[model samples]
Target: MANIVIIGGGPAGYESAYVADSLGASVTLIDYDAPGGACVHYDCVPSKAFIASSEVVSNTRHADDLGIRMPSPDEITVDAPQVYNRVKELARAQLADVTAGLAKTKVTVVRGRGRLLATEEHGSHPVEITPEGEPAYTVEADVVLLATGASPRVLPGAEPDGERILNWRQVYDLPELPSKLIIIGSGVTGAEFANAYTEMGVEVTLIASRDRVLPHEDGDAARLLEDSFTRRGMTILTHGRAKTVQNTGDGVRVELADGRVIEGSHCLMTVGSVPNTTDLGIEEAGVEVDDGGFIKVDRVSRTSVSGVYAAGDVTGVLMLASVAAMQGRIAMWHALGEAVAPLQLKTVSSNIFTHPEIATVGIGEKTIDDRDMDVRSVTMPLRTNARAKMAELDDGFVKLYARPTTGVVIGGVVVAPHASELIMPITLAVRQRLTVQQIASTFTIYPSISGSISEAARRLIEHDDLD
Candidate 1:
């Protein structure tokens, strides 16, 4: 059996180990933290736990809207400590489950950081493992997979002190909720935090360098989210970039480039992420990284070196955890001479966890317009759907895209409560190249939000005929 060594125990590395092991390869997975990576330990799992609690708070506050009586509006309160504890607990449980699975799969787990050694140093073995407080060792590998993941991007002046100023990962460690929270960068991360905190009754201010929040998302979806944030009394600073963050005795101050200074009890930075590729001896091993320090990998996750491969956020190719796992599996399969398929980015679905979630799948409008592709689209409001009305959900919509002539679904966007759940059918349609007629003809439960999807698909078919 071939020996496969994977660096970094994030989704990509851990998943790659399992795949290779199942295929009869001897695999060793190495990382400092528990196996699940940042998605479980920091970003996805923990944040979603907080979001879920906030959702309950939101639902209770709006219970009166559904003719359900509560004791009083003022009496409803969210315990911040409990919320933090819950997030931590869930993250720990998830990490435990992942590590347990890795153990069961017979993949050797190395508890330390792994780095590519100099070609000469790795005369026989290409990788070196340095465990904390332990002697260093080398691994003889038939193939080396790099899944080092990424870290939160920090501005030069806006350094996180982990107290008054924070990164997304540090927010979960707060002892108590801030009276006023300032979030820098209004991308998906910033917007989700803003939405979650607003629901949990924390005053929030969003700093957006762009004209609107989630500038990369669909225009209509961004506008809807902005409107919701405004309705919830969250302050927004647009077209202004955050220059620096400084602790001011009791709180923190954010200085904007436009001669504006904002004060908040705490600030959360959601700018972006930097790949964890530095000091890994990648260049020494003949692996190529881009100008941004991200590993340059092909669709199958092969690095510049024939026996070396890379995946996940380290590759700077779609930073989603699911994509990381898929890329890792593809890398191992390709290396093991097993059947493999290159990644098709357009088929991937991503979700933003906000009060009214935003989920998108397949090609977006910008891509189609840039490619000059002929397509037709139709959008149906969730408010118009029976289930949405019954649940008192009046915001958001379902938008579908299809080829003008063939009626093949190409992409879709959903904005609604549990929009993530509703986007799967649309994602399947896009991935399977299902026609608008086929989607419309599929059976949908009566009075469901999913019915809106089918209804939108039917409308797309009608509009295509008219064009």
Candidate 2:
């Protein structure tokens, strides 16, 4: 049996280890913290736990809109410490669950910092493990999977102080709500936090370097989200790049590149992320990295070195947790003499967890533009759906793209309540190359938001007929 040693128990590392073990390989998983990685322990699970509480605030506040009497706005209060406690509790529970699963799978879980000691021309390497509060040791492995993940990118002048100034990972420890928050960056991370805080009654100002929020998303979806944010009293600063952040006596001041200054009780730097490829001896092990320090890997997740593989954020592919897991699995399968499929990025689905989530899959507008593909698209607004009207939600739409000639679904985007769930059918349609007619013929629940997807597909067919 092949012995696999996986580094950094994030989604990439742990998932890879599990897959390798299931494939009859002896696996060792090494991570300094819990096995679930940052996604489960810090970013995804914890943030969503906080968002869940904030969502309660929003729902209670909006209950009256649905003809249900809610407590007076003045009588209602959000206990931030309680919310933060819940976030931590949930994270700990999840970490425990992941640890238990690893134990059940018989994957050896080593708690420590793992580094590559040396690599042979082919097969096996010596990995050094430095355990916290324990002696350092070494292990031999036939294959070394590097899934070290990435850390929050810190700007030169806007470093996180873990107090008034924070990054996404550090935001969970906030004991109380900020009176006024200045979020620097209008990406997915920034937008989600802005939505959560605003719902929790915090004054939020979002600074966007791009002309609009979620510049990478569908333009219509971005505009809808921006409009929703504004309606909720969020102050959005577009084309404003943060030049520096200075800690004031009581708060902080953010200076924009254009000489504009914004002050707030707290500042969140949602800038970006850097791969955790430093000092782990990646280069010394004969692995090649890109200019940005992300390890270079092929579709099969193979690095330049024969026995070394890289996955997840370290490879700079799609940074979604799901994609990371897939990459890890592919790496293990390809390394072993097993059936494997190279990563197909086009089949990946991504979601932004805001008030009204944005989920998408397959080719997008930019892809269409760049490829100059002959396709047609139709959008159906959620307001037209009976369920949305009943739920008093009118801030989303479903958009589908299809080949005009074959009517095959190529891509889709959903912006609605639980858009992440609503996009799955469209995702299957795209991945399986289902035609618009096939999707339209499928049964949809009456008066449901997902019906909009089929309605959009039908509209595309009608548009095609006109041409």
RMSD to true structure for each model, in Å: 1.5, 1.4
Error of 2 at 317 (Å): 0.9
Worst 10 residues of 1 by lDDT: 117-126
Summarize candidate 2's per-residue lDDT along 147-203 as a digit string, tens digits.
Answer: 999999999999899999999998878879899999999999999999999999999
Q: Residue 223 CA error for candidate 2 (Å)?
A: 0.6
TM, every model? 0.97, 0.97
Task: Give the lowest summed-lDDT range of ten residues in model 2.
Answer: 458-467
Backbone clash numbers for all candidates listed: 0, 1
Report the C-alpha lDDT of model 1 over 35-96, residue by residue, as the tens digit: 88889999889999999998998999899998999857568788888899999999999999
